[model samples]
Target: MPGNDVRFLLVDDIRENLVALEALLRRDGLEIHTAQSAAQALELMLVNDYALAFLDVHMPETDGYELAELMRGAERTRRLPIIFVTAADMDETRRFRGYEAGAVDFIFKPIDPVILKSKSEVFFQLGCQARDLARQRDEMRAMALHRDQAMARLKAHADNSPLATVELDCDLNLRVWSQGAERIFGHKTRDMLGRPVAGTRWLSEETIHLLRGWIADDEGQDSAPRYTTEAIAFHAGGHEIACELYASSLCEPEGQHRSLTLQVLDISERRQAEAMRSLLIGELNHRIKNTLANVQAIARQTLRQSTGLEDFDRSFSGRLQALSRAHSILSDATWSSAPLDDLIADQIKAGTLDGDRLRQSGPKVQISPENMLRLALTLHELGTNAQKYGALSRSGGEVHLSWRCEGEGLVLQWQERGGPHVTPPVRTGFGHTLIGASAGGQDGSVDVDWQPEGVIWTIRLTQGVTPVSGDAPVQKALTSVTVTEESLVGRRILMIEDEPLVALDLTFELEDVGAEVVAVARTLRDALREAADQMVDLALLDGNLGGEKVDAVAEILSRRGIPFCFVSGYGPEHLPAGFRTVPIVQKPVDPARLLSVLHQISVTPVAETL
Candidate 1:
């Protein structure tokens, strides 16, 4: 009790000695607990922790020496301080034995209370200091652990970052260079580290002087060495590189001086991109100016060749606007490529149109800008021709456009109906030649079908006629054939879907087949819980549940001896490898088809389950 605080334990064979010891040591901030005999002391020790044990050496059954030996043997009281209270004069051997039994000091009977209080006070102070020291050590250790973690994270980021980085000291000595630095500079760390920065033949004297000045000003005068600077440095191969330098100080504990930390970054690729961007901007400006001049010349030529002012105005504005729309479509795709659907949409939207009289539907397909521009011009000519003499000129006419994949190519159909009857033109014009010749050059075939009801055209071309990549052809294979509801009767299922509506629909379908919906889960967490908690026979998992990967949930059910299937809107390629082995039911699923698959999976042995 006299350890951490000024609380003392008083033990004596006589009650008189305990009372005298308590009277002497009792103070404003001191606490004392007294025990009459060694047995009572040992009982107190078993129940509570004592800072010090004062014991009478002379006793009837068990003495202070024996109690001290027992205290040292018990784990709880082993480290406790014991002082012998004796009337007899103990020899050097007895004092040594008392110390061996874990006594801190010895006190004579008929004691001096002042000496007793003073000795107890010293032990209390020592205990308090020891506890404080232990707490400080724990705080230091926690701080050290936090610092280590921060340093490790910073090191990992620097090593893995794409940007090249290097560090140099104030004395122009190479200190640190990340893996990116080696990739960009083409210099090994072993060749550069601990070497003079100038030896690399990359750092210019001007750059070094600028760096030194910054370090001295920030680190010396202001006591803060943190700055960012950009310059040109040479790579190991002597190629000029754009670079940014960041410098900071590593100060010692005393804060008298500092070590410089220079973070060097190579931004050559960024600079090159900027230069190329400027060149592209200039090229675009030149093309635009030339196009504008060409439009002006075309307008002049059209006016000269026209039979009347109305004809001249109509022909000039229409052709120029068509050219403008083509240019706009090309610009939107960064002049790389454009979607075929998008090019057609832009052409139709920009040209004369009756929105209610036209409908367009097609599979998504991308086309190169070169092909798109020519295609746009062709479409514009066709739309203009229709407006002048075809269905578009009529009040209640309509045009329907659609496209579909045919083998390795695309077949686009343009049909006009609900218009005045049409007849074939006597002669082909410049517009017809432009549309025909342009498409022909791209391995495309166009057929103009002039019908009595309206005109129709069909264009067939390879999917990737342009310089754009085409999406993989979607293959819908019949994994299983349609089956009757009676085939699925009495089948059991474990439905795992996150959507409430989807789950309800699936349950209804299962019930329609005279089958049972054994269990349903809304999340991967819930699904896993159910798989472990329920007796699942068959599982139907949604491919994505609240953004969690459903494959893991499927794996859980599979491991638990359950047959499972995946339900997803995504294509087969979107699934993980070998996931195809697991049957996939595409969304907007047929109730009868789902029942058939569920029946198949329910009867399938767990050994064959995926």
Candidate 2:
């Protein structure tokens, strides 16, 4: 709305000439004003801004040249462009006179319409451009004012923030120190400004060295704009604080260091939380591996006692369900402890035992997670036995389950009544073995009384009970598995693992296939030494050895041209980027898969294996 101010002036004594010029120049975004006399033209020019004006040379009162000279004398119309229309033949002397009178150009009596429109269009475009430039200048001034206000607000916020804001020069002299830095480091801003940072008490010597190294390395290099690092800083009270520093630097065009801005955030609480999360993850990993090992043991034992596939399915599934139920209870309590009554109640509900025919009594007692698993399995075995051949087999049968604390120990009794006569077993079975194993790894005893009416089982534990290791010995008929590959026989192998039970199980599996284990290294130190010193044809490398990555050992084995495979509790993401192509076996290790991988490694060429 503000830029549409284009107007043109045409002055002539002849009405026909003025009409013709107006018709030629008339178009959109322009206003044409016509004046029949010099006086009228001068008055029109005084009121309205004009882009261009045309004058006739033979006006009655004032000629075109005199009108041009008069317009040039005026303040508003001096810079305006003027063209003259004349019929008389012009000599060099007359042309010079017209030029001196401020006439820019002269058009003949018969004017060309093309010339008139093109010349007027140029002046119209120039007017539009001037308006646009003026508008842009005003907008830029407004933006500058807003930017100054925003910078002021940002400075106030930085000064009051909890994070320490620091500005340093190329020589590491403090240039700007906010109030936050004063509060955190016990130094006034006025005192800290213009001081060298090397003598500051807030930063330790080691931290200063680290920061200086970063700055020096980046000084003359085409470095990134910003960087982040962690450091141990001291508080005003002399207490230690973990600080996370974010730094950005300004540089000259030639890569010379200029200035730097640093924002230091106290991350002590975040660091503690990260450490706790890591500990919880490691503990969870340990427990999961143990659980898998226990499952393997249960499957193996179940297989040994099973008479057929159907019997194995029934027994193994029931045992696993019982274990799952115990895990559920532990999970609900965050794996800290499980109440004995809750365990018994869940078992009774799962076993579908009649509550009216049972007498159950026990004080509130908390058991460890591992012991709860063992107790759950023991209860499953007893319930299955009772439903099959013991008291629960008859309608009139009854069971009495009671427990009480005895001097820092606990004693639980399971008795059966109102059933057929009982006799002692000639040999122990899987049920008997599991029930006996309920004593766990503590000082405990299992006693049974084979009365004429029924049987009674009493379990007493002298200390906190823990589930037995999966590698524990058991007296049972052994099942043999035939070796699938003859290449594995008599081949030497090196094993790198930390868990004793897992290593032992692997050792037995390798031995069963006639492969000799040359060395078993549990730590990174031992693993590196064994890998370099041993002359084994192949190696079994675990991805993690006692919380240290085994990438170094893998590299050594690769350099020696030894074929190898990895066994890890974690997935491929845990593997080193360089050794991701190597074969990996995850826990709990499958005997067949481990053997298959070993056979492949033994037979394949070292170049291909690597």
TM-score on alpha carbons, each prediction: 0.52, 0.47
* Stretches of model 2 off by over 4 angstroms after superposition: 1-148, 152-164, 169-201, 214-225, 235-243, 251-259, 265-281, 406-409, 451-453, 461-610
The per-model lDDT (C-alpha) reads: 0.72, 0.80
lDDT of 1 by residue, 345-398 (tens): 555454354455667766667666556655666677777777888787888777
State, as a TM-score between 0 and 1, how close model 2 is to the true structure.
Answer: 0.47
Instruction: Please give the distance, in angstroms, between residue 324's alpha carbon in candidate 2 and its true position after superposition.
Output: 1.8
lDDT of 2 by residue, 124-164 (tens): 88766765676798889889889989988888888788898
Return the TM-score for candidate 1, rounded to 2 decimals. Answer: 0.52
Candidate 2 local accuracy as lDDT?
Answer: 0.80
Q: Lowest summed-lDDT stretch of 10 residues in model 1? A: 473-482
